[model samples]
Target: MRKRKTPDFLAQAHDPADPNPWLALYLDRSTPLPDEVKKSWLTDSSSNSRQYLLPLLRPIARGFIILIQVLKIFLPRKWSHSRLLHRVLAWGLTRFVSPEANWLILRHFHLGAQILAFIAANSPVPITTTPLEPRNIDDLKDDLFVKHDLNLFNFVIRLNQALRDAGVEMHPPARVDFSMIRDPGLRLEDMPHTRLNFLDLQSAIELFTPLYQLMLTDNDFWRAANSLQLDETIGIYAARLMGAPEHLILVNNKHPLVPMSTLRAGYRLVLHGLSTEMLHSLLMDRKAAQEQPPAEI
Candidate 1:
């Protein structure tokens, strides 16, 4: 008897409609910005002066940012598990800057940087030493699957676990079974059989939105800290000071448009705002769950 072929679980999990369309919408490059936001982002002569001044003060800023990044790396892991510390950090960060800026910066600057880096790194590069060698598109696809797709899958899994710890129970849509691949340690070849249905997309969004909000609330402090800018200056300065990989990638790739940072910042604001709204809804759900009567046997 011939052995049956192993199914492509990843392909089976592809949903054109997307079980959480908001995630895609939030990530999309074509999403439009509001008029007022457009105006706010426009920098004048004063803005240019401030931007120029930032580099002169970079030595001082660099030291301060590095200290903060160090604290962020170490302190969060050590203290984050504490409920009090979580609340305190959340409260402090929320007040440190405008919520508007917080939302804008993450969607636009942070996520954009991550996406661009992923694209550039995964895109085909010439084998400069062997000029005649053909570019391998297969390698590019494999890299994207392993680096981008797998990493995102694991992130969503982790995010779900974090929500559960906070007393909010959320699962992917019934039509989409992620259980087989839920193990964080699972390798690509070890990936189990699963199915994804785009018809159940709305339900998945409804289920996941609360958890997404919790994530935003949890990261609000860090977001606020990173979102700060002086006029024309982009937050890439702070990222560079902290030795962020995104800055290095951007430099290496030589991305044609510096203004993409501005666009990214604007997009982040909208996405963050949406996440904040979701967080509010999640709180309400938690409250309702707490107040619910015990189930009859």
Candidate 2:
């Protein structure tokens, strides 16, 4: 039998010269960003200028943000994840919130998290440079790249525990090892190598999709899980910030790392008041432009 070739990403993961694992992962895209665009984004500006406003409007925007946060404290914990609550809030904001306030909050609060995560992961900090694997989950408790508002580390830990308690089993031929549950300290590096392909991705998604759906629907689980649900616009913006190509951003591409069902649920719940056309332009993949036909002279 011919020896199987290692995927470029997996090979890169093992490369010692690659100091920053997260950056390596970002660059390992099946559809990569153009070199020029990537360079411009890195060198030109760290943030969107439109995401800011005149200095005078800053205080007003801050007040609105604080009011929202204060209101959230008074809300019933269960209602925090309620779809009805999400829609109601979105609707009210759409009707009452100023465009500037909305943009400021989403940009500063939502996209800001992603920006911080990117910087932390790529920084020279040794702990942050560690490869993002199951083993290092505990170390990443406060990490922005891996742990979003939801505290993904705790979420994964709780999820694994929930699966085991529920006696959930994987499909035939792939018995549920519950490895993550069994060995709380288990690391991805310790596991045997297995080729990851589209089929594998599909199977994983299928297996976990229902579990995620159940979690979202279960008020008790959500409250105990302590996950933070984001607005659709913020979710979309965060995706773009993660170096997701324009095609994926426009279609709201569902990366396997996060559940697609959850993302769609946010879109339905929160009205960001952003048109799809505007979003497409904001996150346009310059690389994709190469595929377009030339304009007439």
Candidate 3:
């Protein structure tokens, strides 16, 4: 039997030179994110990005949303929850999704879990459920992402820090365990070594369309994986109660349009696919760090 090679995600995780800046927000925040980067993520915009295309894509997104809505009327309400559907999605993800992409997707759930738990713990009003499992994201079935949303991970971190400054004790999420990602259930090792170097927005839309549609039908798997939208009402309410600064408090205030929301979500989702210039920068930074000579003792 041929020797099994280490997966890109495993190597990337263990690499001493962390390439992705966003990871710092959750994994290590000793270094603050730059203002421009922070602004860009807040608005989901950057100089070289394709947000300009949303105008053209909106009508198409509206049409697709309508079609999915119509199709749902005819299909089994829970058809998206089929175990086989998830299996097929998992197979494609492991084989075609880049290591960085997979890493982001898996990490998002962990981060989201932490934020939800933190919010639940400190909310002025009581939360009925404390969501620890990533799957518990299905609890967000009533919420939705809108245009120009704040990155939830960023928002939570800022809120936590703000609350601490105001003399409130905070409940931080459990430390992330990268090793758990190698579990057989996740199948991260199955990814090919020669995965694509770029992740485009269209590719993300194509990849997530079926899952997104299924999510709309209230499928647990995709809803948990893709539709983890934070409730603006709850988030804002909590932020105000906790005395977080107006600057630190943020939410998806844009009106919901399923098609446009999906496209906007797809735009953000492409980052999970590691297709953005920032992701490329991370990979390049890691490579450069690896190639540098060891420092003398």
Alpha-carbon TM-score of each model against the true structure: 0.22, 0.24, 0.44
Record all residue pairs in model 3 with backbone atoms less than 3 Å apart, i.e. clashing: 199-275
Q: Which digits, one per residue and each the tens of the lDDT, describe model 3 over residues 23-70?
A: 333345332332333332322222121245444544566466567766
Order of all candidates by lDDT, from best down to worst?
Answer: 3, 2, 1
Local accuracy of candidate 1 as per-residue lDDT tens digits, 94-188: 33322222223223322323332322222222111100111221222222211322343343344445555666433222232111111112122
Local distance difference test, candidate 2: 0.32
**Model 2, runs deviating above 4 Å:** 1-3, 6-191, 194-199, 213-217, 220-232, 235-297
lDDT of 2 by residue, 34-109 (tens): 3322322222122122223223343443344345445546665544233433344344333433332222222322
Model 1 residue 268 CA deviation in Å: 13
After superposition, the stretches of candidate 3 with alpha carbons farther than 4 Å from their true spots are: 1-66, 76-78, 124-193, 196-202, 214-231, 247-265, 268-297
Residue 167 CA error for candidate 1 (Å)? 38
Best by TM-score: 3
Off by over 4 Å in 1: 1-32, 43-61, 65-89, 103-297
Which pairs of residues collide in candidate 1? Answer: 103-268, 103-269, 104-268, 104-269, 107-268, 108-264, 108-265, 108-268
- For candidate 1, give the lDDT of residue 5: 38
